[model samples]
Target chain A: MNVEQVRSAVLKLSVHNDAVLSEQGPHCPGSETLDIRHFGGEESIVRPAVTDMHFPEVVFPTSRVGRVAGLEKVRELVVEHHRLIWHSPLQPIFGGNEKHFWKAVELTADFHAEVCGGPKLYSERKGHPHLRERHFPFTIREKDRELWLDLYVQALRNVAFPLEVAEEYWRWVESLSIRMINRRTTFAEPVRVPFNHIAERLA
Target chain B: MNVEQVRSAVLKLSVHNDAVLSEQGPHCPGSETLDIRHFGGEESIVRPAVTDMHFPEVVFPTSRVGRVAGLEKVRELVVEHHRLIWHSPLQPIFGGNEKHFWKAVELTADFHAEVCGGPKLYSERKGHPHLRERHFPFTIREKDRELWLDLYVQALRNVAFPLEVAEEYWRWVESLSIRMINRRTTFAEPVRVPFNHIAERLA
Candidate 1:
């Protein structure tokens, strides 16, 4: 077992209290103490039970505000963000085509609506977001993520979101954006654009 | 840019000569020397130039002995291997249903045929076998990989694969099996099986 698998298990446990975490065989015995504890009270207090293992410090938003500016407001910001990306230098990442751009916009809007404590539009319509798998065809980089976040920042200002609300929402968006980065910036060779041959044929 | 990304880029480059491998922005400037070189005398020799970077030693068989055994013999072994897995404890990993089992069998056979230099049936039909993404829904551990490998080992013997050929084939299978493992043996909590809610509803 690697550090990543250990971390994944710990994170999964931190979220789901009732789930039993185990592997099929005897390996990585050091993770025995990596667990979570819940204290009974008016407010259920939950905390990590292990400190020996090197766990990366994660800054979770303490606020349960859910929708910082409510569902409609979040949707509006998301739509604006997608619109900017549709016309921005990052357009090629979304296929540089109108249909693909709009489809991505719709998907993001639905995803944003669902995540911001609104209707479960994305899950109901698209099962699970599987964002990594969805973006696998594209070689996303740090610049692309920054470009994406910049659009959202502009969208937040355009929508007139409160400073605190915008900051909180930005925190989540920033972290999520980092998760969607699928490629490295210093590769020995350039990753081939998903279907260069097909595009060449069309050209 | 990081060690993992650098390693992935080099490995990808080493395998596919025509593959254009480039990372986005400049991050790891040192990787410029970590490259492959082609020497032409009688046969073009290709290998990694840099040794400082952490790269797993991969033994790629240069001999195009496509099918160690004949294609028909390989197919026979692959069929038996899947049949054994279908009835074994590993069945649950493939969905534990007849339809899913058979579909998996067909896909694996196609994949095996292609890898053994038989035909491009798998790629032509299914595109790139995003094997990791395909198995992402399942929590695959080291033990599962061992079980899968065991089935193949037994099947190879059953088909009377030549000892030298079988050993060479086993080397590749063992390495590929390691790549398929996506999880560890112990977690802080159990992984949420894909479609848990739906399964509960059905039960």
Candidate 2:
């Protein structure tokens, strides 16, 4: 086969759901076997994978809010948080016109609300929330993530978010924010502030 | 002044060529004084700077080529290097349709040629090349950068780039590639491959 045809075939097989691609060859060492299944009930096709790099996953805090009032509370908290951050000193990080900024805020609110057990507004409108890809345009450093979290804490306190679910929510945002950091300024890992440390502020 | 007015004023001052802004107040600790000047000959406006973060700069290998056939040789090497990478296993890193890929390649070639002592093609067509911001859409890791350099070395040998100029070119790309890495897979700093180590390969 020509190089183009070979690449096309490999790409087709790699994307197939029932394709079981193994990279345990000379190309990549110590790579895991990927058992990708295609929706089509086609026979499994095995191929030597190119690169097995995986993008970071964003796990939303839906279950935590589901235990409480769920969607309504999530919407309230997310909207208030976005508002607080929009007004905060971190506003420059948005780096776009006012219209773009508000549009981003709306989309973000929809995504957060949907993820945290609200209606499927974000999914229905924007399909999948590729949060990392969406955030790639902005240069988010470790300090920026910290600043974001700080504003979020302030928003939670200002909105009087329920202290019962505050810890889980904080944990979710804290971890997820780390994934948004596209720029590294220091060799040290990002700082982690546990829920107990900010419990009194939320109360 | 209102927040928007203050922001606009700050942005104006920050972008000014002669405005000396200080972030040494309670806001940012140990921040250096920024002597930014405005081209409009307006009086310097000193203000409490917002964030003191600086984007990484891309220093091209213009001087090294000036010592040889200058722009012509740089263009030849850059074009061949790009062609090699486009055909390499790293093709997926471009992540677009064939038309988009070719456009990116052309734009990149223009930018590289302009930066490496060629004509003002990129700047005339596209404004400032915010390299990091432009590359934000791609999930470039340390491994990807290494793979890029590997393909680059092969390109250099294939094109038979001058030995004298090759070292500087390699150094330029090696350091510049690190800045392109937005995703951090390891806390350790990115690997550095000295030119001498790959001297045999280039020969």
User: RMSD per prediction, one decimal?
Assistant: 23.8, 22.6
DockQ for every model comes to 0.02, 0.03
Candidate 1 lDDT by residue in tens digits, B1-203: 54333533454344223122221222122223312121111221222121111212223221243444666666677789888887776765655368867776777776665666666677667653434334534555555776787677677667776554555455555554554454432221222222222223222
Q: Model 1: per-residue lDDT, tens digit, A1-203?
A: 54333433454344223122122222122223312111111221212121111211112222232434666777788788878887786775665469857776777776666555555666666653434334544545545777787676677667765554554455555654554454432212222222222223222
Model 2 DockQ reads: 0.03
Q: What's the lDDT for residue A144 in model 1? A: 72
What TM-score does chain A of each model score against the native chain A? 0.58, 0.66
Give the TM-score between model 2's chain B and the true chain B.
0.66
Candidate 2 residue lDDT tens string, B1-203: 53323433554444222112212122122112312221011222122212112222323454435446466666666777778777765666665477877776777777665555556777666554434434544556567788888888887788777888787567667766765676643323567888998999977
| Ten contiguous residues minimizing lDDT sum, candidate 1 chain B | B36-45
